[model samples]
Target: MDKLTIALPKGRLFDPVVEILREAGVVNRELDDDSRKLILEDEQLEIDFLLSKAVDVHTYVEHGVADLGVVGKDVLLEAGASVYEVLDLELGSCRLVVAIPEEAGITSLEELPSTGRVATKYVNVAQEFFDQQGIQTEIVKLNGSIEMAPLVGLSDMIVDISSTGRTLRENNLIEIAEIARSSARLITNRVSYKTQHQRIKNIIDDVKAVISKQ
Candidate 1:
């Protein structure tokens, strides 16, 4: 029997996923420490674990490199890859928001420029949001330090995710609008789901059952 290869995200989201998997009696080892190897094996169940970046987990599953993946909804929205977003894990819950400097005196999205500059890592999602609003803003794609854009005058506003809003507050920024509320999700390739229907469904059912209880 071929072992099911599962790609697990390697950051904050991993803890909850591991906990849930343990509850399901699928995960038996620690996934908590850093400086350790990525892959792990649950010998009894013939499960292979591949630890990867949160953003790239979906790609692994989508490409059938791994049968399944645990990723954040932010990644799902941003990537928009052709994969089955099976379950909302409801862990690592947060919201993606558009924010501006508090001192900038921009209280609402409506008051912003028609073609103002915006910065974010989620360029596609950001563009789609502006397109929906019928607004035209230049998107400045940044890999990191998105909040600094408005502060240093690199951009007028930004599109980013927030959990407690503490980062926004500390940066003297306020959320003008929320793009979407996100949580961790279980996703799989369309082909994998079709080919491994019973196995995939069982895992999905087990994970969802655990989530439903919380």
Candidate 2:
């Protein structure tokens, strides 16, 4: 029998993904998040779980290295990976927002210059959002700590994911616009969906049943 390969993001969504898999009766052992092992297996259910960085989950699924992935919707939009979004796990909820320094005095995107510099890890998402708003801006991609961009004069503003708005507040930045709301989603590779139809459907149905009860 062919085993199902599942990729799970290593951050906030990890615990929830584990819970879902346990509820689905596919995970029988305790998962150790701090372990050096990246790949885990459940021989009884013929499942392999690949633990990966949040930003790389989509890539793993898209390249067919993993049949399914659990990742935040924000990462999905930022990557724009070609994959089937099969289900919303409704976990790790957050919002993507455009923020500027508290003293910037810019209440909206319109108040900024026609072409301003914006820093973010989500370059694609920022570009698309600004384009749709008819705003032109230079997008500077950063790997982490986007809030420091405006503080250190690196950029005019930033687009980043905010779960509690605490980080923005700590950095003395205020949100000017909401880009999108995000949550964990179950995504599948197209080819894997076709080749492992029954196995995937059974897992999906099990997850759906768990969701319905929540």
Which parts of model 2 have CA positions greater than 4 angstroms off? none
lDDT of 2 by residue, 34-98 (tens): 76999988888788889899889999999999999998899899888999999999998899999
Query: Can you give the TM-score per candidate against the true fold?
Result: 0.95, 0.94
How many clashing residue pairs are found in candidate 1?
A: 0
Write down the worst ten-residue block by lDDT for model 2. Answer: 26-35
What's the lDDT for residue 131 in model 2? 90
Clashes of each: 0, 0
Candidate 2 C-alpha error for residue 54, in Å: 1.6
Number of the predicted model whose lDDT against the real structure is largest: 2
Model-by-model lDDT, in order? 0.88, 0.90
Cα RMSD of predicted structure 2: 1.3
Candidate 1, residue 85: CA error in Å? 0.5
Tens digits of lDDT, candidate 1, 1-214: 5688889988777787889988876677665526387788878788889999899998899898899999999989999977899998889889999999999788888987777899999999999999999899899999998999999999989999999999999999999999999998888889889888998898889887888898
